[model samples]
Target chain A: MKLTESLSFRNIKGRPVRTAVLIALTAIMAMSAICGSLAVMSLRNGLGALEARLGADIMTVPASAVSKQDFENIVLQGSKGYFYMDRSYYDKIAEREGIEKISYQLYLASASAGCCSVPLQIIGYDPDTDFTVSPWIRKSAGGELKELDVVVGNDLSVFVGETITFYGVTCNVKAKLDKTGNDLDTAVYTDIGTIKRLIAASLELGMNDFKDIDPDKVVSCVLIKVADGYSVDEVLNDLNLHVRRTKSFKTTDMISGVSESLAGVSGIIGILMAAVWVLVLVILFLAVYMSVNERKKEFAVLRVAGASRSRLAGIVMSETLIITITGAVIGIFLGLLMILPFNGLIEESTGLPFLLPDTLHIIICAFVALAASVIAGMLSSLGSAKRISRIDTGVILRGDN
Target chain B: MTITATGVCKDFIRQGKNTNKLTAVSPTDITIEAGKLYVLMGRSGSGKTTLLNMLAGLLTPSSGKVLCDGEDIYALDDEKLSRFRCEHIGVIPQGQTAVHSLNVLENICLSYMLYGSLKEREAAYPAARELMRKLGIAGLENEMPSALSGGELRRVAIARAMLRKPDVLFADEPTCDLDDENTALVLQTLKETAQSSTAVFVVTHERDAVGYADICLNMSGGSIGKQ
Candidate 1:
């Protein structure tokens, strides 16, 4: 072993209680940093996903689906369900003075029994009028989607060119969307013709629940883009007054509660991380101080044995660094163990989108956390190192008798 | 080399209310030459250790200069003085000076390692084992200081000091807590060390220490006199 390393190892090994306390405190600091950063990143990604996937200023749904509870479940919690509004609402909204664009969509759910990997929501849109899903489909799928071609969400198990069956009708997967960490992740997008054919197939198989409903006359929702000179409230007021049995909602307002909840959670985690840092720093300082105080005579002996003051200080600093590095490794390992494997469960329980950042992002965070731990160790040990450097060797050695 | 102390004294500031200053050691002149065992005899607080510390370059005298080979030792800065002591001076402190974590061999090689004279443990092990065997601790190289007797720890301290074969050896009460057999052994070792052309200064109240001295001095009430 190198001289400094051997000396530091011997010193740490000699004092078990001091070493253990320092390691434990540093571990707590690192663990808090990792977990807190993970949660904050997850929330940030979730909010970004919401912004990207919603892609519309306003949505008009059936009046029965206007409850705040249902709105939160569908928008924030990614729940799988379907509702409908009359197709006439889309025509009226599109002709309004302030409307820039309008598109209609139909929603349905697939059975869990051998349909796909899981029970999922399916959305069908008109390619000619769609302003949202069509742009992404064109960008990712390289062209317009045909009658039987479907784009799957990031969470689906199927790949491109694979087939997924819905009520005895199978469709080809053309492209896969990027992860949005929201309900869109579990959705499949196809043209309205496929949905109509699936509906007809269901009706033929004795699943006649849709026999009274005409696919051409009904839509689940209408997405609107207000004109440049008009505000969303102006269009919303006009739509609510002119349209019957339809409710308009701003996409931002629909998920404002979730945004507030995320802010609260992030604030708490920030405070918790700060508190852990303060506590760890205090404990580290105290532990090092006490250990140094107790070893005054030993330091004096080293001085008389021809050890320079800087060398003594280096020993103390080296011991602290070793403990900090050990703690950081263990703490980060535990953090990764708790987070990576159980991310889905955490998302379900928290009712928030939980996405692990990519490998490079995780690596950067771990490096930053480890660096912070090293800085903490250095800061906490500074006083002790200075004291060791300035100790009066003659007095200590002579007085020890 | 010869260590010369010219009217050196030490004064410490007392902490109590009058803020009085206490003179721990009165000014005294002494010369410690190589190839001699010099014993300074004093009771518990007679300034023997203070004078020894001054001579060993561990402390600065308040009044006079401690010169080694005609160069004032106190003129060197802390760093240079530390290097000088590492290469030229060795001190066995009053009691229990072993670093408790290191075993016997590591303890013996510690001084050489601290001074960077030996870069690797392998380079230090042969010398350390030779010293340990000379001190009658041949088979105890792997034993911890905590498991050793008082005499054994003292021998380890002595081995550490002598590892670099310094010119001057200053031992403050080297046999303070030892039985008759260990005391004799320790004194005989110091006697043998002094005869090997090193200046050995031993501060002790033990009468037996005087028998091993080539020159003896008595200390009383912060003053020294020839014995």
Candidate 2:
């Protein structure tokens, strides 16, 4: 038998309640660890995928009119906003020799009565010329997007065909687009003309502040794509000189910001996981220490009967290992449960653009938890074990006392 | 089979207000030999068990050496000394030290295994069964010590100690809780074990057990004089 099996069979078998408690404690710690790990890994992967797909390069906004402290924040802070694109800057970019084709797209967060309890985002574009749809968009309708006709993304399609009142006018879901497993999946693609009409109508209905949008003029942000020949710096400089109050940013910067935020979240998660381990170990140490103290005389008897201190220590350590291993296995299963439900949440929050964690991450995490638990058990038992194993039998067995 | 204890002193400092050092046991010199049944008789505070423990290698002397077969047991490192004790010495405590979780057969088997004679089962088990049968508690092999009567527990404890076939066997209060008839039976059991290559050391103040020993050494006032 392994040291663990023997120790458990001999020692733990005697105390049913204690053994159960130790296992439960270890399992709970492991579960917390797994939950923390899942959160970190998912958030990181999601943000990374977002950055990669969006080509997170540098961006330029209308240089802050505010002081240097808030200078960067002036244009950047309003994370999701729409401003008019200056036609004059577009003319300058075309006139520059090295500069290549320039395209622009508008954005909107659209919602309608749907199966989901939350509002969804809708993006409108001129499929033929929009820079954001320059290459990847494959129009499943066999022709370019038209006025009032919306090509529903995979996510939107579920609630798309059914009438969703947008600005009090019902629209049709012309066709369902392919899944991108990204923010695109949550978006509804239609002609820019339809969006402009919606903005005009909502304003007519007297809705002004966003949830109540003046649909007549509502365009949240404009996505501008620079051609391969012209560097982003050149375009940014030109736009800064020509357009006032209109922010010109490469798509890259926005995506990078999302990725950085995820990194910060992952760091916090890791710290929480570590704290759980330490807490669990402290609990284990107390339990084992008290139990060993109760059996002091028993250890004395064994020592007198010719058990070397090392052998006795081994027995004590083995008892802990056995308890920790049992608890860790249960904890891993619990940990997995903790991480599982959040898989869909991660996918939704990050737009499902990143790779889902496979069995490998789960298995590796479980093994690590088990190993840490066993080490914790050993550390917790150290003090009591020394006292018992090195018992001074001479004093205990003397009849004079 | 010679065991020697020389110039032994032991002091116990009880924890309390105005703490005092109480000298419990002080012995000059003593020797034990093969085939001898020695009895140590003492009053409640006479230090009889302390002397017995010193001889059994369970306790180290405050300032002296206990040599068994020319080697000071205390001088030996833990493993070597423990091995010597496991193989060469056997002790029967006052109450049942027979592990309660194990049945009779397992307890007897454990004694043989612990003393490093696991393969010598034919010599250990049959002897255990014959001893049990002679003690009149023959068929209680599977019964736990908690379930057994005082006499039965004592008999089983003796059976385990004797099964190891050690060079020396020490018993403390072997017949304290037994009637005359049972005492005689236990004494006979001791005599049979002593017939083999072993020395019998009994520590008790009981008159009946002391009367039957080959050597009776009376103890009083923290010293063993003569019988």
Candidate 3:
């Protein structure tokens, strides 16, 4: 018969349990593919963000900070605490032969005060000497920052033109950076004058750590760009040898470490997706095969009513396509429900970057996932369709009576 | 329309070391003419259903041809043969042929739907309703086959075969499990259908059906005997 929607619907509805099982299996397959793709895409975007944010070839932090919190916490986590070395280290690194550019930043954390909504990490850099954050600030703000103006991260609640008070020192938000899906999303960027004023205000507010700190003579970290024809390793070695009481790190090395950590998770999800698809394919094959076997007499009756073998095969394939397409749509919807609203929670629990693709890309991926499931269903039903096409109408009819 | 079978026979290969072949139906020649009811009466395993299946173009004969009108039905390939049968031949298979998922009306119009002649349910509903009424099943059109009585299901199958009004109609034990009244009703409908241009063939062991047939043949041990 013509493979109409009514025909497929009735066939599936006739065998409720079989249809339910097949749909469930196909849904699981689609769900696994969607969730897996989401995770892999997020990780890939997060890694890209991390690489772009770390514009420096090498970074030098106080040796004490490395001993206290290790490399990952200081660089990857965007730790709020700050430790500093003598400002003379900047001159020492600048004097090196292969140093193309060098900039130093002061890191400070706001006290938990009633004036602020949350304690935020504040990064203070010199606009004239900085190559890392200056280009972004210029692109976003279109001009240099005033003494008390600040650029906020995308995740912050404060908006441009709003004033945020840190330790009783208020600063105007000049611009907000886009989300990078990393620690930078929660940081604040400003000129050195703004952070020095905040530290002085913290001292006035009776903060003990700020009371003894000297913002003028101290530097938190130094970012260096290697000159052409000079490797990052050579610059790193030179900085380590010349700059006393500080440790130098290659940004590429830190990124490599982050990628290694992600490899394990990506591997697990890949295996899971593959396993689910294989299991779904086998279950669908068996379900269709058994369904066809049970309905041999029915097929014979249709043949007697003048249905060709190809028509019988079409019926079987149509039923499979209906189930698979329904299951795929449902699965994609469920995957979205699980992933979209709770992405922050996922990031927190996994300690990895979670960035969902844009709506267009997500829709494309969903369609591809759905098409894959339909193709899988068609392949699984091929054997059953062949069997139905080759059925002996007269033999089955005689046997049925 | 007339169905002519010439030197038709069927054999089954029994697999073993000896490879012996068993003949299911011996060589037989017969002609079933239009506007007449023909009944083949036989006990179980008498090859009555086999011969009926051959006449309906459902099986390929080992030797010889069964012609419908002027063309050998078997000479057509599978696709052409199926189309030809859909347009000109109808078979009401034995016992419980009703599809459980479809209502009586859907079952009645299944042949037209299968052959792509009827695309919409509305287009076939009138014909199906009329046939159901002729077979005394007018009210059961909306009821599922599972809810129908044994005789009602039989009538539904009969209505389905007759909906297309094929030139040849084959019914195999259509009245097997029906009560006497239902059986007589079914036989009378078959007789009325035979009075039209359609040729009717009924394979049954029911002695009562003999009274409704214009020509009756008795079958025993794979051979046909005129009675």
After superposition, the stretches of candidate 3 with alpha carbons farther than 4 Å from their true spots are A1-5, A67-74, A77-83, A86-91, A95-97, A111-113, A238-245, B14-20, B116-120, B134-138
When 1 and 2 are scored with DockQ, the better candidate is: 1
User: In terms of TM-score, how similar is model 2 to the real structure?
Assistant: 0.73
Worst 10 residues of 1 chain B by lDDT: B112-121
lDDT of each: 0.84, 0.65, 0.84
- Fraction of true inter-chain Cα contacts (below 8 Å) kept per model? 0.60, 0.23, 0.59
Q: lDDT (0-100) at residue A127 of candidate 2? A: 50
Clash counts per candidate, in order, are: 0, 9, 0
Best by TM-score: 1
**lDDT comparing candidate 1 with the true structure:** 0.84
Residue B178's lDDT in candidate 2? 74
Q: What is the lDDT of residue B25 in candidate 1?
A: 91
Candidate 3 residue pairs in backbone clash: none
Model 1 residue pairs with clashes: none
Error of 2 at A53 (Å): 2.2
Which of the predicted structures, 2 or 3, would earn the higher lDDT when compared with the native?
3
Candidate 2 per-residue lDDT, tens place, A1-401, comes to: 33322433556876789889988988887677667776666665555544433432333333332223422221232112343334444444445443444443445544333422225555566554554442344446555655776666565545535555566656666667654434555566677787777666555566563444443333333344566776877776776566556555665555555556656666776787778777877888889889877665555556545667776777688788778788888888877775676565565554324334567986786777778777777888898788777676655544213
Q: Tens digits of per-residue lDDT for model 1 on A213-309? A: 6889999889898889999999888888888788888878876767887888889989999999998898899989998998888888888988888
Where does model 2 exceed 4 Å of error?
A1-8, A56-220, A224-275, A346-358, A398-401, B16-20, B96-104, B111-140, B143-153, B177-181
